[model samples]
Target: MGAAAYALWGSFPLYFSALAPAGSVEVLVHRVLWSLLLCAVLLAALRGLGDLRALLADRTRTGWLGLAAVTIAANWGVYIYGVQSGNVIEASLGYFVNPLVTVLLGVLLLRERLRPAQWAAVGVGVVAVGVITVDYGRVPWIALVLALTFGSYGLAKNRVGRGTPALVSLTGETLLLAPFALAALVVLEVAGEGTFTSAGPVHTALLVSTGVATTVPLLLFGAAARRVPLTTIGLLQYLTPVLQLLCGVLLLGEEMPPTRWVGFALVWLALVVLTTDTLRAARRRAALARSAVASAHG
Candidate 1:
């Protein structure tokens, strides 16, 4: 399930690319509106409407979800633009950098202390960004925006606290954005720029599929989370970006100049360091638990 989720996420470049002549904003608006409709239907079928209502009643949680909606919307918009503009490799870099960005957010916002290995990993990530920036001859703003917005979205979701069903939370977020999305669609249509009516039925179907494309992976990941260890999920997270990178370079035929290669190599090195530390930490905790159990038995 985890692999399937990541694979679907990684293949998004191909999906978004196929939406050409629609432009990023139009695609994003359709994604938001259709995803909301789908979420509403799923919630009703699952009898989760009560959960959604309860979530909306909480002012604090609703505010956090609102922020989450904004950040994730930005992430989706920037990602669509990147894929549509043939910057798939750079967009892939964003996800590759996201875990590190999350860690950085923890240190800065939560005042969490990082272990030595984590510090080293973050340092390497910074240098990797610098190298990539130089290679691009400008700040890789698309990558940075994607990473920061996604990191912010995660933080906002964390503030909303757990125990909220993923579907419920998503419904709330999309509900918050639905009005704006609807208005945008209307404006686009008034300007004769909307593709929904003008685009052929195949294009319309593909556009509508954006909702399923967005929701299915989340459902898969949610299911996988209940059955897998956090460490396993952490490891699985890399699969999405790795597949995306492959799609960009192999399928899209994007050039990876030597300097860009070196930058990505550094990012990979940092991920290796971070993953090793995570595995070691998980093992230590397991060993401690085993020792405690043994003592209790004795």
Candidate 2:
């Protein structure tokens, strides 16, 4: 499920490019509105509306949901813009950096402690960013924005992940944002700039299907989270960025300077270190658990 979810997300550039006639904001608005409607229908079918209501009734959880909505919307908008602007490589770079960003956020905001190897990984990530910035002779704002927004979004999701059923949380996010999206669509229509009105049946169908594209991966990810350990999930997160990077370079014909590749290499090194540390920790824990059980039997 995790692989499937990340793989779907990695292929997003191809999907978003079809919505080219529309602005990123327009595409995002449609995504929010259609996704909300889809989620609402699913919740009703599954009789999960009560769960959604319960979340809204809880003020703190609701606040986190709102934050998650804003961050994810921002992430979506930026990614679409990146694809449209032929900055898909930069977008891929952002996702590549996200795991380190997420880990740093945990250490800083959640007061979690990192082992030596994890800290080394974080340091390598920082160096990669520096290298990329130097190569550009300016900060890669596209990458930075995508990484920061998504890292924060991930943090927000973590806060409510265990308690909220994935479907309910998804519904809440869409429901919270749907009004604004609908309003945006109306304004665009009034200004005679809406794609929905001007697009052909094929294009319109693609636009409408955005909801399915958005929801399916999330549902898969939710399922994967339940069955997999965090360490394994963490490693799987790399697949999306790697696929996006390939698509950007090979299919999209995006430019990658040798310097940029160097930066990517460093980030890849960091991920290797981090993954090794996580796997070692998991193995140690499993061994200890087995030992404890053996001692108890004795």
Candidate 3:
């Protein structure tokens, strides 16, 4: 399920790329509006309207949801911009570094312990960032911004707990942000800068589908989350970047310099280390469980 979810998410670049001539900001607004509409329908169909009402009733919790909403919307906007502007490869780099950022967040914010291998992976990621900086002759701030913002958004969503279905939470989250998005759409329309009204058939269709394309994977991800462990989810996250990288290099015809390739290689190596460590940990736990069962039988 996680694999399917990530696969869908991995292919998102192609969908968003079709919205040519539409600015990322306009595209993002359409995404929020359409996603909210779709999510509301799903919530109603699933009989989850009561959950959304309850979420709104609690002003305090709703405030936190609002924060999560804003953060995630920002993350989405930045991502769309990255993909639309020939920076899809750099955007892919953000997700590539996200697990390392999550580890750092745990260490700094949650006081979690890290194994030596984890530290080594972090070290390698640092070198990759340095390589990218030198290659660009300046910091790739957009990539870093996307990584840190999305990474932080993930942490916020983690704190949101899991009482409601993902569809409901997503509906509530988007509804919270919809007013702002609507206002922006109105403003852009007034200013003659809106894409929804002016963009041609292909671009307009692509913009509208952003809602479905974005929400479905998230819903799938949420479903998978209910059934999978955090480590498994962590492993699945790489599929998104891998797909985006392929889209950027193959479909978009973006040129990757040797140094950028080297950076990607280092990041990939770090991910391999991290994945190996998690798999080893899972195996050890499985072996211990089997031993316990054998002892009980004896």
- Quantify how close model 1 is to the true structure by its C-alpha RMSD in Å: 0.9
- Candidate 3 lDDT (Cα, whole model)? 0.85
lDDT of 2 by residue, 66-146 (tens): 999999899999999999999888899999888788889889899999999999999999999999999989888888889
Local error of candidate 3 at residue 27 (angstroms): 0.6
Using all chains and alpha carbons, the TM-scores for the candidates as numbered come to 0.98, 0.95, 0.92
Q: Model 1 clash pairs?
A: none
Order the numbered candidates by TM-score, best leading. Answer: 1, 2, 3
- Stretches off by above 4 angstroms in model 1 are none
> In candidate 1, what are the lDDT values of residues 159-254, reduced to their tens digit?
887788889999899999999999999999999999987979999999999999999999999999999999999999999999999999999999
Q: Which ten-residue region of model 2 has the weakest summed lDDT?
A: 154-163
Specify the poorest-scoring 10-residue window by lDDT in model 1.
Answer: 158-167
Candidate 3 regions exceeding 4 Å error are: 227-230, 285-298
Global lDDT of each model?
0.95, 0.90, 0.85
Summed backbone clashes in each candidate are 0, 0, 0
TM-score of 1: 0.98
